[model samples]
Target: MIKENPLVVSVGECGLDYNRNFSTKKQQRYAFREQVKLACELQMPLFLHEREAHKDLLEILDDVTAENLTLPPIVVHCFTGTEEEALTYISRGYFIGFTGTICKRDRGAHLRDLLPKIPLERIMIETDAPFMNFKKGRKSSEPIDVVDVARKIGQVLAIPFEEVAGTTFKTTSSFFRLD
Candidate 1:
């Protein structure tokens, strides 16, 4: 199906969701593994979605890595993990995507502070459309809403909003090797 869709740049938007565990662990595992393999076989980058299943997710990656699977680069989209988790993935050369949800007053604010600690080159911005709405009083999000993410990240890093947008845009384009 992806081969038939030239516009699809990713093989995933897939991973475990332990937060809700909407699917059984075994089921999530199966889907996650299949998607990982598909991403590798297709030579397409993965848009990874991980929730409270970090341990399981990392374990799967380790297994795949041990098998010498040539997986394309991955981005942990709409990341809401701890700084330690973020650093762990960063150390392994995965890009971290931030969303407008990071602008919230609670944990999101902590991630905001953590952002400046991350190398600018290792970052990307996403909206995770139809979810993670951060606009004041808004209840949903859209891809175009990623601009808010860019702006918030700019505030966190003390950089101009356009600079953040341009830099992250370049970083994402380069990471995916997109034109």
Candidate 2:
């Protein structure tokens, strides 16, 4: 198991994906629960993948907290959920990872609006390579595209580009610490 591997830094690619439903809801729920427990038990961070399942996701996390389990630091990767959902996750002390979705003026408008609601400290930026095409309709996003994400964030929040880049870099580094 990855938990036994010293090189493992976080438990992930885990969470509910209702949009595709590639995995049955039962299977996803069970796996998500187990992974959350494993991460909590191991004191490791979580890199989650969620799409159109915010309600269920929050319920599950709340259940774990009800059980007195201390959740590890969690970053909802490529977060493009609703403003309410984003606020809910923020309230739970979970971090939000922004992808190129915010670059889409129309589609990303809500996220831009919610950005002001989220504390900068709880923010992280990602390229979501081979997944997000945030680079002006390129084949797919690459690590270099992270600059675009940072730039959009700076533009929306009215913060300087350098500060956005430096803060997110620091936040990500601290969240996924080894040991």
Q: Estimate each model's TM-score.
A: 0.93, 0.93
Instruction: Find the 10 residues in a row with the least total lDDT in model 2.
Output: 132-141
lDDT of 1 by residue, 23-110 (tens): 9999999889888988887889988989988889989888777788887899998899888889888988899999877878885977
Q: Clashing pairs in model 2?
A: none
What is the TM-score (0 to 1) of candidate 1?
0.93
Error of 1 at 47 (Å): 0.9
lDDT of 2 by residue, 43-98 (tens): 89989989999988888888987899999999998998888889888988889999
Global CA lDDT of candidate 1, please?
Answer: 0.86
Instruction: Mark the regions of model 1 whose C-alpha exceeds 4 Å error after superposition.
Output: none
RMSD per prediction, one decimal? Answer: 1.5, 1.7
- Model 2 Cα displacement at 166 (Å)? 0.9
